[model samples]
Target: MNVTLLMAITINGFVAGQDDDTEWVKDIDALYKMTAEAGVAIMGKRTYDECVKYNAFPYKGALNIVMTHDKTLLTKSTDDVIFTDATPQGALQLLEQKGFDHALVIGGGNINGSFLKAGLINEIILDIHPMVMAKGIHLFEGDFPYQQLELMSFTKINDDLLQVKYRVKNNYENS
Candidate 1:
């Protein structure tokens, strides 16, 4: 299956910060709309829970896969949503089994870190917000091996947000 990482980071280079208001809701909502239109959505436990809380709606009719340690918490349903406690590797395995052509990796830090460390991500779609916070979680927790990216496209969405799409360079043998 083809893997893609979709995330939004603040211009200051933080994901989550001291204040909960980092325009993340708007960014995430935009991502959710895009992914939902694409027919599948995958996210970390924290992000999934946050979406559930904020949206006040279950991801019904859409494939909602949650990455977490507690697999038992996931409901059993194939028609709508399915949860798996798999890390990036496990999730990719499951997606492969299900014959998924593409998957979106949504996260704050840990999720992105796992994919980058494992060299599994194929593309990155980042929504850059134009505000800086003093402290917050970054997209990369620490300095991992550098991976080159080729800018595919970019669009200016309003004055405060920039949507950039990049393909991970030579990260995948067949890609």
Candidate 2:
């Protein structure tokens, strides 16, 4: 299955720094619209909780899978969300077995890093806002090893945002 990590970070690489009430609603609406186009959407448990707190429920028919360490959270019957303790590997394996063509990894810093560190992400679609926040959670935190990417495309979405697409470059010899 093809996996894409979708994220919106500021020019300073902070995801939550620019997040405010107004910006969050706009971001969630955009995210839901984009994820609805995909077959499946995957998110970390922390992100799921934040979504619930933010009241960003998607359409009733939309399918969502949340990765969590606690299985008890799955007991709540929700039409759109399924909880799984499946780490990155388990989640990917399940998705592969189910024959999902594409998966969108949407979230904050740690979740994005998990996918990147696991080397499971094939592509990235980053919406970079043209502002900087001096203090906030960054898109990647802690000590995760590095991977290189090749720029596939870049588009100016507006005066303040740039949409950049990148492909993970695994073969250094070709580079």
> What is the C-alpha local distance difference test score of each model?
0.71, 0.73
Candidate 2 per-residue lDDT, tens place, 15-123, comes to: 7753432252234456677788876788877777777886864423356878787758867636567678777878878778877778888866777888777778899
Any residue pairs clashing in model 2, and if so which? none
Error in Å for residue 156 of model 1: 0.9
Residue ranges of candidate 1 with Cα displaced over 4 Å: 19-29, 71-78, 170-175
Note the clash tally of each candidate. 0, 0
What is the alpha-carbon lDDT for the whole of candidate 1?
A: 0.71
Off by over 4 Å in 2: 18-28, 58-61, 77-79, 171-175
Model 1 residue 44 CA deviation in Å = 1.3
